[model samples]
Target: MDPIDPVHGTATLLLIAAAAVVVLLFLIIKVKLHAFIALVLISVVTAVAAGIPIADIPTALTTGFGSTLASVALLVGFGVMLGRLLEVTGGAQVLADTLVNRFGEKRAPLALGVAALIFGLPIFFDAGLVVFLPIILTVARRFGGSLLFYALPAAGAFAAMHALVPPHPGPVAAGTLLGGDIGVILLVNLPIALIAWYVGVYRMSKVLGRRFDVGLPSLLFGEENDGTGSSGDTDTKTQAPPTFGLVLGLLMIPLVLIGFNTVLSTLIESGTIAEGNILVDGLILLGNTPVALLITVLAAIALLGTRGGRTLGETQQLLDSSLGPICSIVLITGAGGMFGGVLQISGIGDALTTSLGGLGIPLLLQAFLIATALRVAQGSATVALTTAAGLIASQAADLSNVQIALLVTAIAAGATVLSHVNDSGFWLVSRFFGMDEQTTLKTWTVMETTLGLSAFAVAAALYPLVS
Candidate 1:
């Protein structure tokens, strides 16, 4: 019986992976450890424990870094830079200002919900946080409530896009890996994600806001947000807020390009456009071309600035600032991909996919359970998303491409569950709310669980109806 063989003993490999989670969690939660350092340790632990040679660790790490970073680095780089600018120039502050002032104390959550839903579509979860956190800081100061109230909404908004939207890297890569139709997948999950945002984000934030007070300890606060005041708000005048139109225009470049590519490709395939026509090819280049976000970021830097009424040099500096926050998340996600890559190359994913598929469990449920397990173990949603996507794509070959896309989103939702000590998000919440780890666990973790279960629940109800 080969240990990695699916039929004979593949469960042992999975069990080993499962056990690694417990060990990793202990290191972080019990030891008061750093996640950046911890994730690297876990990657090595997972590989060797599953029987990979210690000598091959370097190769595995490189492979993971190259593959995951190739897809995410650009988007993340742009996100970081853009978020830094938004933070410095008071773009997010503008949104927070309007919402907090208009809604008042009782309805900050609703404002958060709307803000997250709107802003979440364009950027990754953490990027959105870096960009918009000043707003959360402002709201917390005005209302004297938990940062979780606004943070959860912002988190959910980005989560929805990461899980449901196209070209977001996670689902896009998964969809490609599984031969799924990207457009079909987006259309199917779009409405469902919208509903989940309302119930999972809005209602939960409102409840949590009332129940908990949010912000970080004085020491952590001083370290993370400097000169931002005791409540973490540094802006005094609120002079000129960033223009909504400009901010949104900058965000739309990638979306429009990708969408145009999808549509033009469809038309080309249908023979509606002559093959190889310059006009058709130009349109395709606009959207389908690789490095879409890269190009957009450059354009944004050009368009935004003092000459055009964007705070001079703020956009450039903003992008520069986003990189500081990028280190931990990028490395953490890269490590997860490294483990997943080993599973992919080792045929472990194949074995597990086959073994699980035979159980008659719906792919949706299987996605939920797998994501939940890894998330609880490692406490990284990206890790959960990457691992589940890798494993499920192996099994999903037989599924309709549309179904495959939905599965990607479903896995994302599941991995979203149980964010705690090992998860950076938990700390982000804790820092924002000024709560210790324990209370952060009670609220932030629950908000994440709501996102995970509610997303699955929503997808489950819709699966039958759609299928």
Candidate 2:
């Protein structure tokens, strides 16, 4: 539900918007408030201050929150289930081990990063990193160098993919809000994301690794007996890890289905095929992001769970457990959407568009700058990207397909930059890597900036060709 703006003037709405952001930052960062609560509180304040009808505020808040959740909740839920299946059954280890063996020790970081890029496709950053922690530590200990050499590349890969690609909530929410085609986004993002990661994260981490001498921790997350690279499931003692080929197949299924949808839609649009063709109709259902994920999750359970020796009941329990840790993320994401909705309804978006629209800056640049400012201000990439996309939605209406997709990537790149004290990712990486705040700023923060700017540069370069 798009909120009707009660406040008419640009200056008034702009001041109110600015105050909302400052208050939000103060509450979340300085006051140590929970992000979900902080966002909800600030959103309400923004609405009231912007002269939203007091009686209609509830409608605006729910409209934004519900709409965002309609797209996000399903993807996140299915994706997490799939990731949990892989992690519990040791498929992640199979993939990691195969890559490391194939790439050799000298190029360990590259190999880990590649494997992460693959697994990271269906997983959130924090959860993915946790699942891969044992593997990263194992590689670091074997190679005998600073953990950052291996850890940074892998973490950077997850961070890059999560920020820039679809089916992860950030890009998906931004794409949905900006009216970009999800299938097109998936298609164009692959090559761009890969190159950006290699240049920004992979090579950059190698350079930074030489500068920082971070020691590998003998233990992490209080798991004392953490020798095995498995998901700490002692019950999987008797079960053999799934073969690498099998794991790879399960991961590829969703991508194939999604690609099929993209190609079919393109063909239909070009008049090569009719839109109502039975084949097209059927394929569309299978290719939808949520449906593709649902099918993948079922396949993972069947192949990795029941057929791999675990009972259906146990598998059900595992999938159910995956939801618990992610509840906060899901809620926070919804709240972020609500905040963006308030900005939209309060006329702040239109105000910015009107005042700043004539700067002659490219739509992609404006997206990046706005997203970067929001990320720096609020410290949540999902929030920043969605809010930025919402603010810029009016302008994106005239952009070509490729331009819209690239603009989404640009916003994502902006959101990815500068993880710092206010950003939860900063703390996540710092604690997981056993680095102090200062070292985290030097290594993790620097790596993030490199990744973001590099991706944005790639998008900017592609902009002219597409535009």
Candidate 3:
């Protein structure tokens, strides 16, 4: 039998949910506990408090965690492995160097940001940042300026893409739960996403970078090593880098494949092609995000790893090593889903939204605000987005495809806001850039808020036309 929430009142359940979030924040940031542990603890406590039967609590937790992981874990694992191969094989440097040269020294930050935007398409924010860290450091060392000038643009690009675009967990999960068409969401949001990148990230990074003249760290790129054991190796200094064309082709593979999927599905939907044809089925299969990424990874292993002179054993080792760091990320994301699931089963989202629904706010704005609140409260963008989508999904059923896509963009915008002590991305940026907590708040936090708010503004402005 399915378990039911024991709580009788919506108001009471909402309060319990709020208290659970507070405890979660306290445990993680104030008490210095691990996030995965904290999220699991809160999920269980909140479940019990919401009157979930003792016998069903375990099922509730696992269902949430497993469902999230089912979608997230494979994509993250494959994406990171692909990125690691590129990074280690010098493919990333080739792309970075080519873009910087073409864009000129004065536009170095723009070049890096552009490269990041492309790289960010298939990769998650954290993995993309980690992969790009060495290049960011190398450029800063050569150019002799504050790392922020070089770093923020790239960071913001990844952040923007991750939040707004699909195949990234945040938007994908949000779209899935909201009943938004993934292809339509990707197509409709592309222009807005680019504009958001330019307005929120590209232009703003320069101002913030100049305002905060932070220094580059001494051993920041230590993880990036040459085959000869020297740390912080680059193409120009030692070996022949992979050709820019080759690197670019590799990066474009996933994008093209995924885009093909989007286009083919659209064609099928419009009755341009028979839906059940074998060729159509095969094309769609290849276009699946995870499958596309998997193909890209195998291609990278052969071209980048094997052709680049690494043995099979060495390539295997690199892929294995990449998985270790991401285990924590995967676990925390799953736990966040678990927490969101608990809130869902207890009817907190429905209860809270019903109370807020009477405020007569537009559904677009409502989505953005609810997502923003969840983001600030929980510090996990995927959880905030998925939870917010769940809350508003029923109400949004009558909206058009374009409207649903815009709503997804707004929710993504809200999910991107206010990185602080509670957010893991904040610390990752802080540590990598060698900024103290206060400086991180000033620079990274400010960049994030700007990115979120600008995207929200653009999405809000475009809502009228779509509606």
Candidate 4:
């Protein structure tokens, strides 16, 4: 669909965007409306209020909704299936037990977080978190404390990697738009992301975890375990638990495949590998997130699902059950995307960008602020990063490569913060963790802000040195 020009001035668009978000929060938080219905209803109202042509309103709504689902549905489906198999087959238990043994009970959360940082390098946040759900639950259930202790560190680590590092679209797109070397951006930002995660995410999790005693959510894997490593699954109770090595190998499959794709794609972009090679194309297809996850699910069905006297029919049932719990989650997330899409098409982000572009702040600060505004406006971090980078590109022409990379870091930091009602990620964490909207705001939202601020501080301090 073609972009729709704003029929009103910037102020009117901004007001409509703000009013829409307020009404959305009111509907969900106050009126007790189902998030999916509220999001859809508000999306329709917002489209009309923002002056979207009556003929194009449906297209705007479905475009955002469908686009988000296209990325999310398969990942969530395959990921939950993999997680269910791991949970029921005791693969998650094996991994959790090994980590607890090596790291000791006290350091289990840290161990999970460090592992997620590694896995997150090649995986996006939603997929990585979904795949890690069982392990996190297994560990948290064993340790008997707030789930936040175990969940936030791991979740935040993935968020950090996804937002700041390459091979994840946000930073990669920002780096490209700003003419930063991808290799340099990766090398430079990796450590910064780690530091930011440690300071902002890991450290804050301890505080928030202690403060908020969120229990384990039973949404995905059913009832809590009975302390016998069985999550109330009958087949799992009789089957011998999977070996730690086998569990680890199953988890590593996607990581290795996705990493191969990232490396190969980077090489091709750098002209080290020729494009149009049949083998490379095939490998890249295998490495696509959904395809890689699909392959992993199939492998799990063979190795874990049917190995312990469980029939294929039983395995299919297990996978089938996983989808039911996630249907609402999937819909709510898509609707959130729809609302954001309406805002984007209505020119809220464009209005904000135009207004902020001339603000007389320092270039790095301007970059961060613009990205933050766009993120807050439209709820997509990738959109924020790419849009903000393009907006600042001409002004940054005389800067050094290192300076541009630092600017990219700043943009990423801004995009990372302030995820709220409009962001699909906010709902993903809220539903998965079983936290209500307000609770999610207090914990996940706050952690994201601190994480972004920490990253921006690092980038700002380094910007002058590079100059």
For every model shown, the clashing-pair count is: 13, 0, 0, 0
True-structure lDDT of candidate 3: 0.75
Q: Model 4 clash pairs? A: none
Which candidate leads the pack in lDDT? 4
* TM-score (all chains, Cα) for each model: 0.69, 0.70, 0.74, 0.98
Q: Rate the local accuracy (lDDT) of all candidates.
A: 0.61, 0.76, 0.75, 0.91
- RMSD per candidate (Å) reads 6.0, 6.1, 5.2, 1.1
Q: Give the TM-score of candidate 3.
A: 0.74
After aligning candidate 2 to the native by TM-score, how far in Å is the CA of 322 from where it should be? 2.6
Error of 4 at 28 (Å): 0.7
Residue pairs in collision within model 3:
none
lDDT, candidate 2, at 317: 78
In the range 1-467, model 1's lDDT, one tens digit per residue, is 11233222577766775666667667767886765566577767766766666676667656754676565555556555554444445554555566767877577767776766666654556555544555565555455545666667776777776666664556565566667776787786677777777777768877987787655333212333442332232322234655766666665676666667756765565457778889878877866423556666576556544432445455455455446655655665555555455544444544454555566687789887776666655455665677677776767777775567567768878777777544545544454345655676777778777877777887777666656
Question: Pick by TM-score: which candidate is best?
Answer: 4
Q: Comparing candidate 2 with candidate 4, which one achieves the higher TM-score?
A: 4
Task: Give the per-residue lDDT digits (tens) of candidate 3, residues 329-388.
Answer: 677767766776776666665565566656778888899888876676546677778988
User: 161-216 in candidate 2: lDDT tens per residue?
Assistant: 88988767788788878888877897888778898899999999989999999987
Native-to-model Cα distance after best TM-score fit, residue 159 in candidate 3, in Å? 4.9
Error of 4 at 418 (Å): 0.4
**Tens digits of lDDT, candidate 4, 377-429:** 99999899999999998887788778888899999999999999889899899
